[model samples]
Target: MSTENAAVNFSELVNRNKQTLARLKESPRLLLHRRDGEDLVLTTAARAEQDQTVVSAATRMLASLARREPGGMELLLGILPDVFPWVRFLPEPDLHAFTVELVDTMRAADSLGNSASVAQLLITWQHTAEVHSDPELLAALTRDHAEDYGPATNPRDVA
Candidate 1:
């Protein structure tokens, strides 16, 4: 979809459904902006399926390349910094581990036809890097804690 005309208020779908659908015909996807919560992407089933197909094929190819070639994983590692500069905050060993886990998770996600795990993995790693970025927080997290405060509360139990 063209970025210029790709986004429209979510109300367009509720009030001007037909016009919004027409816009989909011109561009394969639409970014629906919402004031209340997270924005959403609108696209035809065909387009979504096509995107999944591409992701699956590309991921499979990368997996295969990594297995067959000695430097394939290294090649991906070399580019990760450019694509995700936040990764620079991660320690060297963690960076390598992250790359390995990312590829494995991506392959599994593509096989399952769901990218949630991949997104979650990235978020988890990003949070890790964020912690490592802060010295006091990292030390607090890594330091020993022998005393038990209390039973941990479940997030769902909170109002």
Candidate 2:
């Protein structure tokens, strides 16, 4: 075994165990944040429901990744309808705008090849939206993303 071959083998071993390497290969733009005494995997439904801070942190990380990656926007946009299913039941301007922005960000992220981060963000957003029922907000979101939302029609008529 020559020095060069030995060095190459060592490098490969190091790369295999690194989390960043796995992320880069599996989902390059996805951001993973470490919390004190927190497990990366949520084993049960109760644990997932009880972990608000972890969920919020994950959301922020996704938002940050979308901001950093332009292609992630499309994925973000795709998430709106799925996250806010009750958008057809309420009337609120601010929530509507927020949902629109989130969708736009996803679209942008997707364009930039940040689909993984967008997916992660969507998961977090859906979970959060489910826990906090804002009828108006949900309705507004549904209205804003109606065109690209497949079966869901936009409540307002636009000419």
Candidate 3:
């Protein structure tokens, strides 16, 4: 969607989901805003729970925004503690798909003038990609996952 549409849609969505939006606004780690278009997007400064009610709510809100704008959706999926568990369990193909979706959403958000969201997505993508590149951190994450989940069968495994 155009930046103008994104902004309008974002404002409308926030207004519609006032409660959840309010909670998100309260989060120090989240960047929620509307660009110029009818697009509404949420960008996270860090990873959040994929399965958390709030995250799910945000996702739903994004979906609604997409429907309203018909241009697409913008979302930044972070690799924070809450979301790691679910993302880790995703199959490789699924994980890649998720990444694609995230990148696309971020791009759309950026087009709409949501700098905070864009920055958050960039940070998250960098962190996740870097974490995989670093053997030490990867090993530590694996160990932690194993400790929490009773044996890490996959790098994506979460407790």
Candidate 4:
């Protein structure tokens, strides 16, 4: 499916995903925007489950792409925008760890001599505009996914 970036109401978007998982696959690049003041509040359990689902699904998709072409690292830059509505909602350390791995992968891909990864790069900017606008979504993502984030691709000891 083609990537689309259109202005949308939060409520409408949620309703759009009511037939989720199956539907989410069809709109992998569909970015959502909220009409001002439309809040999407989730109970803690609901938030945790959704967070887990998003992380799992996004990670699986990214990993597959990475495996298909190592340049998939360039693709990771889109993770925040593509999988998530709010970048700020993402936990910093987890995101950071992921980013570190992404960069390493990108560098490895470069060594393998790729000219570029256009589709991967394109979806990134397409999704960036919608990030950082929703606190509720961010809270949910951070709370549930933080502890589960690692076994980092490269684990390290802190001083």
Off by over 4 Å in 3: 1-95, 107-112, 144-159
Which residues of candidate 1, in runs, are more than 4 Å off? 1-5, 34-38, 146-159
Question: Which of candidates 2 and 4 is the stronger one according to TM-score?
Answer: 2
State the lDDT of candidate 3 residue by residue for 1-159, as single tens digits: 122211224455556766554545444332335465443346344433432445445645664554555444323233422554545544466456666666557446644544477467646655666676678887787674423446448866756
Q: Model 2, range 1-159, lDDT digits (tens) per residue?
A: 121211113234346645433433333122323344432321234434445445555656677665667765555544655666644332355345555566566556645545566577556655555544766665676575535546665668554
lDDT of 4 by residue, 1-159 (tens): 533423345566567656433343444333344567544432235545665566555545666675567666456655655664444444556455555555445554444434254336434633442343456654565475435555655445653
lDDT of 4 at 138: 48
lDDT of 2 at 67: 63
lDDT (0 to 1) per candidate: 0.89, 0.49, 0.51, 0.49
* Top-scoring candidate (lDDT): 1
Using all chains and alpha carbons, the TM-scores for the candidates as numbered come to: 0.81, 0.26, 0.29, 0.23
Model 4 TM-score relative to the real fold: 0.23
Root mean square deviation (Cα) for candidate 4: 17.4
Q: Which candidate, 1 or 4, would have the higher TM-score against the true structure?
A: 1
